[model samples]
Target: MHFISHLSAVLALAPLLSLASSAGLVERADDASCILTASGGDDGPIFVDAVQRCETVVIPAETTLSIATGMNMTGLNDRNIDLRGTVKFTDNMTYWINNGFYFEFQDQIAFWMLGGNNLRLFGGGAIDGSGQVWYDAFATNDTLLRPILFTVYQASNVVIEDIKMLNGPEWINFVNEGQNILYDRINISAVSTSVNPAKNTDGWDIYRSDNVVILNSNINNGDDCVSLKPNSTNIIASYLYCNGSHGISVGSLGQYAGVYDIVENFTSTNVHMYNAENGARIKAFAGPGVGAGIVKNVSFSYFTEGNVDDPLVIDQCYMTNATECAAYPSNVYIQDVVFTNFYGTSSGNEKSVVASLACSPDGRCSDISVSNIYLEPPATYGNATYTCQNVNITGNAAYLFGDCATT
Candidate 1:
């Protein structure tokens, strides 16, 4: 009877032993380092435990940690995540829709959010969203809420560098209400292999953030390479190579009613745009019942482009009909904006129109200057054309935009 009891005890402990072995959780002699390998199951809980317990968490090479649930590793201090392997979120739409962390802006969700102080996530690994299913699903249902791949939410003094982000469902990296953040040497690509294209895959969207820097990055995506949303200030992006993007844009702002938006002190330079829709753009909403905003002290310089549709654009009457735009006009005021050192070839999509500065009818745009711009359309499209409306143009390239209309 004692022997039988011993065998039953061992049998009861078998599952625990299997779980510990599969988790591959190793504690080093220093006690500050934790190494995690893939458990081939739901690794989200294991990852969270390591991150909460250790100061330095390392995911070794050739390991792919699968996460089925959302991770919120926020409120951490002085953490280092050395990712030498891949961290892939599972393609379970129903699970994510119910379980992913939801954000109010744009009704978006996220699979993972990392917010902390003095945190560094690097080491040249990749974060895969497994976005093929989302891409195909979004093609059928446009209203489907797709989750962002990575988000820096309410964190300060963070650096995310030398990383590869693949196949994000929507925006890849979102810096929301963060300060002193730097994204350098990052590579992002989101392309669908199916008939349904990857849509709304912006490289980086900075909202309500200050003192952010994005440098030396390559983005091949569908939407804006870098966008400064409302209340974004003191932001700089440089040395970027963007392909199939919507340019380095500012302010698709003033969309919500009774809300005030502001994007100021933004600069983008040394950008090479290829096969894009716009090279440099600023878009704001118009018509009745919309919010008011201000875009101030913004500059775009040293941009080289090829096969772009509109190399330079400023559309104040965004998403509004011409009659409504002329009737209501945009409430947003644009001031102290400069575009310089632009050399590009337009795709001739607008025939001879290479640049269009269509501001609102009122004196809403001021101190606008353009200089050293040499853009040419295709040889078959005759000469390059620059169109302007309701704004006085100043600078060496001011003559490019013929006579300004006052009425």
Candidate 2:
């Protein structure tokens, strides 16, 4: 009790000091009286920036704004965020997840965001997501398909930089159907605990999007650190550091069916994976009468894996169907998959070989190649095996291919 009182007294007296002494629960505003500031009201006809308090603001084209939050930013409509000094959300909120986002509803603490566009952050600051409410709510609800950090749709040209997301809800950064998106110089970290320690918390999930670039980011999540899902195409990720999660994945494709399905032109290079599940995987379920999922022109190179589940898993015989246990040839076409300069460790029982390509008998995964691959497992498993009926391997692990000519 005395310590709490003393801390409160110090906080009360601390503001009398210089702004340099500012710390927690501190709020600052942009002042037009000192320098240049956006001029006007919130009628979509004004250029509002450099102010202290605003319920809703319309940032004019080619304008900049800096925001500090006591609660959160709600009702942020379409705006051009050309520049921002800094944006800080409350370390604690009434709810569990204090997401510093433009919510979908008009009320703060709501868990949805609708509009996004041309939002750029220059001068290196942060948009912190204190995902307390999201965490508490998801856990209580036991909702499987929950997203944590960001939820924006139908927006375009989103640029995020120099931010640190300490704890996320489910998926940290979800860029959907937006074009020319870049998440640069970002770090997302969440250490797993025994209870509720980050499950299915993928680092960056891009679905139905194009021309996305994720460069120089570090991720520690519970699921695929970087996942390129169905309808996500023409993507590139480089210089990524992943820890204690599923390394990086291409598909769990055909989850959302359509003629408009496929994730293409994807590349993951210069990656470092440690304490993770399968380093590189292409996962899909098996069923019948579903639309076809065709994946083509994907490449992975220069990666280091640490004891991943299956250094590489092509389980086309996914057990999504219980009754159809013998159901083979899930309509998705897995083709032109290549692995090169890949070095990694494997599982407890068998670590001999580094690649496992398990496909269906009828629609067996074909035209797959692995080159310059090296695996050193922990004495439990030895010499990774290639068991695809219609796949061809032509590298160091190729001589094990006794029936390479027939299929």
Number of the predicted model whose TM-score against the real structure is largest: 1
Per-residue lDDT of model 1, residues 1-407, tens digit only: 00000010101111111224346654433335667778879888889888887677777788899999999999988787888899999999999988889999889999999998878888799999999999999999999999999999999888888899999999999999998888889999998999998999999999998989898999999899998889998999889999999999997989999999999999899999999999999999999999999999999999999999999999999999888989988989999999999998999999899899988987999999999999999999999999999999899999989887954
lDDT of 1 at 47: 90
Question: What TM value does model 2 have?
Answer: 0.71
Task: Score candidate 1 by lDDT.
Answer: 0.88
Report the poorest 10 consecutive residues by lDDT, candidate 1: 1-10
- Candidate 2: residue 48 Cα off by (Å): 11
Against the true structure, candidate 1 reaches a TM-score of: 0.94
For model 1, the superposed segments whose C-alpha errors exceed 4 Å read: 1-22
